[model samples]
Target: MAGPGVSRRRMLGWMAAAGAAGVTGASVVGTRLATAVPAAEVVTRQEIRTLTPDQRTRFFNAVKTLHDNNAANNQYNRFVLTHYNFRSQGHGVAAFLPWHRKFLRLFEAALQRIDPTVVLPYWDWTLDSQRPERSEVLSSAYFGGNGTGSNRCVTNGAFAGWQVRYPNLHCLQRQYSGGSTIGSWYSPGMIENVLNTNRQSYDQFRRAIEGSPHASVHVNIGGDMSQMYSPNDPLDWVNHAFVDLLWAEWQARNPNLANTYNGGGAASSNILAPFGVTVASTLDTRALGYTYPRWSGSSRPA
Candidate 1:
């Protein structure tokens, strides 16, 4: 449930009361309370298309390594299970953005463990809204094309033969909504409308983005991407990186409302579940050690 009606004043009041109670942790509201990261330490997440040849090779190799590590605590399967088990807490709620922000951070950290130089790259589907199948991000050279055969198993690209462990052992799969092609996605104009229209409230903005472009991408991609275990698909990471970037862009545009969080019967101090940190802590991307590239004058990133 989402509380789009929660006002800015009420949200601020909740933060004030939390501070007065002497709440001291990453969950505390207010940007000033967030632990500051050194500028040199902060890394920028770039668009998937911008990654160089070597960068692409390293990233794909690192991800494949994680997938191949099938030990007792396999890091890759752990993420997919986490998302599958706690799917409800992260979606259709005000904490959607914050929950996924931390989710992406943890996933990125796992990748870094394999290759220190690798960072998560976002897939700006807006660039391929009209013909998603043609996007380089989904080419055989990258994430791979649509699933083939009756099982729809992906047989090309970085994760072509990946057989996910959670639930059951099955080859990674994808089914485009439009036969061989995925139908149109949310355009830049559509995302800009979401950003412009929901400036005053956190829940409003969260719902706008989540219900529109966010859901569209998942539904349009189909197959594992449309399921709770969607993280099984590597594209889930880059897709969410872009979603998280949109939330960051919204936060940047509303400096005064940076800490404004409420709705879905959630308090700012409420934990994001699984991730020990509170929702408040996940609000600041820089504090988490990464941010998207600078935004151009247009809604798309530079």
Candidate 2:
């Protein structure tokens, strides 16, 4: 909000505000926290934690509140359409990678808004690819039995690396079972050029989070049909949060990654700046910095 460098006095004022927020946030825990042990270091496992049938119902219902629609997926609807329709004349630019990132981000924010204590647990695909990557949709992995709804892996690619070929994890060979739209959520590449193509290893992750992409654990926006960015939509909040996590992970990996997402251009949607937050908004990672994360606060990133 000020100059390139904020003074220590300004920083203190912000911290003081964060401390008060922590107090108010403590009152809303799910009680389940006291009884539940944190999932064992599942980070490397990428075990897609499926929400239980009950959790699934709750999660879906919550998402509907924001989108003003029911069951975002239709029988013929596939979130993975990005890989096909972009740039009719030229080869698609990892088409799906950007759109799906945004959709999932919106999807997850809808989830957390309802349950602040909830964290969108990632389904570690590395450990459980055997269960059929298609079966790992959040609904099934977390809760079990959504019936292998969609496909995530692909049969074709330039490199065997799942990250590179699938980008955000989608391949033409991968098809959604409940009609074709199911596999659409998987993204196809380095996403934005700055994040993937133009950075040092560590900064690469942080920069990848441009504009409305990275809304949730795996939720990234894919289709970049229009350049206009509007914060009026919840997707804006969702995308930034998703990117924030990736940056957090990047920071963890390098510990010294250049912690910022400040450049803007035709390539950079830079959706985050309009909201007036920082690369590290959460003393714990809060969006819009409205409320910092606290004991039970979901706004704070883990």
Top TM-score model: 1
TM-score for candidate 2, residues paired by index: 0.34
- TM-score, one value per model: 0.83, 0.34
TM-score of 1: 0.83
Q: Residue-wise lDDT of candidate 2 within 50-158, one digit each (tens)?
A: 3455654454345334333222131101221221222121111221222333333333444456664344434322122223224434222232221122443332221
- Evaluated at residue 258, the lDDT of candidate 2 is 37
Question: Candidate 2: minimum summed lDDT over ten consecutive residues — where?
Answer: 221-230
For all candidates, the clash counts are: 0, 40
lDDT of all the models against the reference? 0.73, 0.28
Tell me model 1's lDDT, rounded to 2 decimals: 0.73
Model 1 residue runs over 4 Å out of place are 1-40, 70-73, 264-268, 296-302
- Per-residue lDDT tens digits for candidate 1, residues 1-302, read 21122233432332223123322222212111112233348898999888898998999998888777654246677677666655666876677788888888877777777788998899888888787889888888999988999988999998887887655667788988778877676677767777888987888898787764766676567777766668889999999998988888888988988888885544566887777678887878888888887553254544
